[model samples]
Target chain A: MIFSSALIETAVNEFARMPGIGKKTALRLVLHLLKQEPAQVQQFSEAIARMRQQIRFCKLCHNVSDEEICSICASHSRNKTLVCVVENIRDVMAIENTQQYNGVYHVLGGIISPIDGIGPDQLNIHSLVERVQQQEISEVIMALSPTIEGDTTIYYLSKKLQGVPGNPVKITTIARGIAFGGELEYADEMTLARSITNRLPLENYMQK
Target chain B: MIFSSALIETAVNEFARMPGIGKKTALRLVLHLLKQEPAQVQQFSEAIARMRQQIRFCKLCHNVSDEEICSICASHSRNKTLVCVVENIRDVMAIENTQQYNGVYHVLGGIISPIDGIGPDQLNIHSLVERVQQQEISEVIMALSPTIEGDTTIYYLSKKLQGVPGNPVKITTIARGIAFGGELEYADEMTLARSITNRLPLENYMQK
Candidate 1:
C-alpha cells in the first residue's frame, strides 16, 4: 500500500514484520496508534522494548522471567518434583490458566520438527535432563502438542532421562482423547480410536 | 492468563488494546518479539513511537503528511479542481492504490454516526467546506462508504457547500453496485437491486 508519510510507512512496516499481520492489518494497527495520545503510544512502545530487552529466560525451565529463575521455579507452594514439559512459553501460560497443574514448566522453545530443521539439540533438553538428575524430581509430564513431532520429542526425552545415573524419573504424558464438549461423530478417526482404546472407567472419570 | 513476567504482561496488554486483537493473539505477538534481536525490537518500538510523535496532518486536505500540504495536494499532475471526500486516511490510500482517480482528496476523519456520538462537528467537515468555497474546484466526489451514516454525512456536507457564495460546484457520489468478483446469486437484495438500477451502458463500461 502507498503511505502518505514515510513515518507511517516505517511504522506499518515494523508491525507487518509480525508473523500473522499483513500490510492491511499493519496499516490498521498504525492508524489505531495514530489515533491514540502520543503518551499512550509511547507507553506501548516502551513496554514492548522493555519486555524484549530486560526479559530473561529461567535457567531451569527456559520460560520467560524477569529474573534468573522464573516464578514457577521459585515458588514454594508449587510441586518442584513435578515438571510439565511444554512446547513454548504460551503453552505454560495456557496450562497455568487452567489452574489444574500445580507443577513447574519446562518450555522446549519448540517441538522437534525435522521438516523445519529443529532437533532435540536445539531445544532446552539438556537443562531439563540435568534438572531431573540433580533434583529429587518424581515425575516429568510431557505436555507438548499432540503431533508426530511432540511424540518424537517425548520419546527422545524419555530415552535420555532413562540413561541418567539415578532412580528412573517417572515419565508420563498428558492424555490424548476426544476433548470435552467435542461430539463423538465429529472426532477424527485417530482420536476416536485412541479414546476407545484408552477408555476410562466411570469412577476414574468422575473422580478426576 | 497468568504471566510469569510483568514486562511481558504489560506488552501483551498493550497489543490486546488494539481492535480485533485478543489476549491470545497479543501473547503470540509478544512471544514473537521476544525471539527477535534486541536492536530489531528496539527499531520496531522506535518506529511506532516516532510515527505517533512526529506525524502531521495536511493543513489543506487533512491527509497524513510529513509537510503542511500532503503530496497529493502539492502534486502538479493531480486535478486540483476535482476533490474526492473520504471517511479516513485509509480510504485515501485505498483510492490511491486503484490509481484510477487523478483528483486530490479531503479526509473527513469519520462519517456522521449518531449512535457512536460522532457528528459533523467531530469531523473535518468545516475545513472541507471552506476548501470548496475558497478554491476553484469544479467537482466534488462523495466517495464515502455505502452506509446510512455515510449518506447522512454526504447530505450534510452538500447542504453546507451549496451555501458557498460563488460559482456552484457540481456534487456526485461514487457508484454503488455489485463487486466484480462477487457471485450475483449470493449478493443481498439491496445491492443486487441497486446494481441493476445503476447499471452502466456497454460503451461507458468499456471506456472506463
Candidate 2:
C-alpha cells in the first residue's frame, strides 16, 4: 500500500511509460539512478532535456540537426542532386549507416496513412515537390518502408511529379531491400542485400 | 564516416552508457525524443532531474525517501519493534509489495562481498547496531540474499549484536526463499514460498 518516495515513484512511472519497461524494470532503473553519483543523474536529466532544445529539424532535408541545415544537406561533398525521401529521421540514420548512398535525405515525418488520418498534407510532400522543382535535383529516391501506406505515398508522389518541365527528375525507390510487409528497420543483412541488387529502374514503370 | 549531428550523437552516447543499452538502442531512444514534442522531452528530463534533487536517503533507515523518514518507518500502524534488515532499498520495496510483513526495514546499502572489496564497514552495519541498541526493537529479520556474502554479513551482525546487554534482540533470517548461488532478485515463486516458510531462529546458533 505504502510506496517508496514520491519523487522516486514519479521517475519510475515515467520510465514505465516507455515501450518495453515494466514496473520492476522501472524500479531497477530508478534504484540504479539512486546509486549513481549525483552528477551522473544531473547529466542524464540535462541531456534528455537538452535533446530537443539543442536539436531541430533541418530546414532543407528535415533530418535532425542543431542548426538550420543538417550536416548532410550542408555538405558540399554529398550529391545534392540525388535526394532520398524517407519516412522519418530514424530512416535517414539507417540509410546513412549503410554508407552506400552519397546523396542527401528528405524526411517525410510519416507515411500517408488515411486510416490514421495522416494525409499527404500532414507529411512534408509539398516541400519535397518544391525542392525537386526549385533545386537542380536529377533523382529523387523513395527509401520508405514497403508498407501499403509507404506505397501509397510513393504512387501519389510519382503521379504528382510526372512530366515536370526542367530535366525531368528521375523518381526511384530503393529496391525493396525489405520483404513484403516487413519494416525497413528490421530487415536482415542478406534480405537487404538482394533488395538492393534487384532495384528495378523507376524509368521502366514510366514507359509502361 | 560522417556521423549524425554532434549534439544528437553525444546525447545518444550518453544514453548508451546505461546498463544493457547499446549504441543502436541509444540512437533509437534519442530519435524517439527528437520526434516527441519539446514539452514532453522537457517533462521527461525534468522528472529525472527533480527525482535526484527532491529524493534523499531516509536518515533513520537509509531507504530512499522524500522526507526525513521513509513511509514504512514513519507509519504509526506498522510494527515498530520488528525490523527487517535488507541488502538494499529494492528489497525493502519488494517485501512491502507482498503486503505480508508489517515490520519496519533497515537497508544495509549492500551485502558483504570481499571479492568486490566490500567489507562490513562499507555497509550501514554500525547504524543497524546503534538502531538495535537505542530503539525498543525485539526482532531483527535478515532478508539478505542466500549467498555466501549474505551469510557472512548475517553472521557478523548476529555476532556483534549478541555482545550487547539489555533487551537481547532476537535475530532471524528470511527462510532461504532463495536457492544456493541464486540471487535474491531472481528467486522464483515456489522457491520464495519455501524460503519464507523455512526461516530459522538465530538464537539457536548463539549458544554455540
- TM-score per prediction, in order, is 0.90, 0.85
First chain of model 2: TM-score? 0.84
The candidate that wins on DockQ is 1
lDDT of 2 at A70: 84
Clashes of each: 0, 3
What lDDT is reached at residue B72 by model 2? 78
* Per-residue accuracy of model 2 over A27-125 as CA lDDT, tens digit each: 777777777887999998887888788887789988888889888988889998999999987788778877888999999989999999999999998
* lDDT of every model, 2 decimals: 0.92, 0.83
Q: Please, what are the lDDT tens digits per residue for candidate 1 over residues A1-208?
A: 7877999999999999998999989999999999999999999999999999999999889999999999989999999999899998888888988988898988889989999999888999999989988999999999988889888999999999999997999999999998889999999999999989999999998987
Per-residue lDDT of B114-199 in model 2, one digit per residue for the tens? 99999999999999899888999999999988778988998999998887889899999875445557888788876777867776
Off by over 4 Å in 1: A185-201, B177-202
CAPRI-wise, candidate 2 is: medium
Find the candidate with the highest lDDT and give its number.
Answer: 1
Q: What iRMS does model 1 reach?
A: 0.8
All candidates: DockQ: 0.81, 0.53
TM-score of 2: 0.85
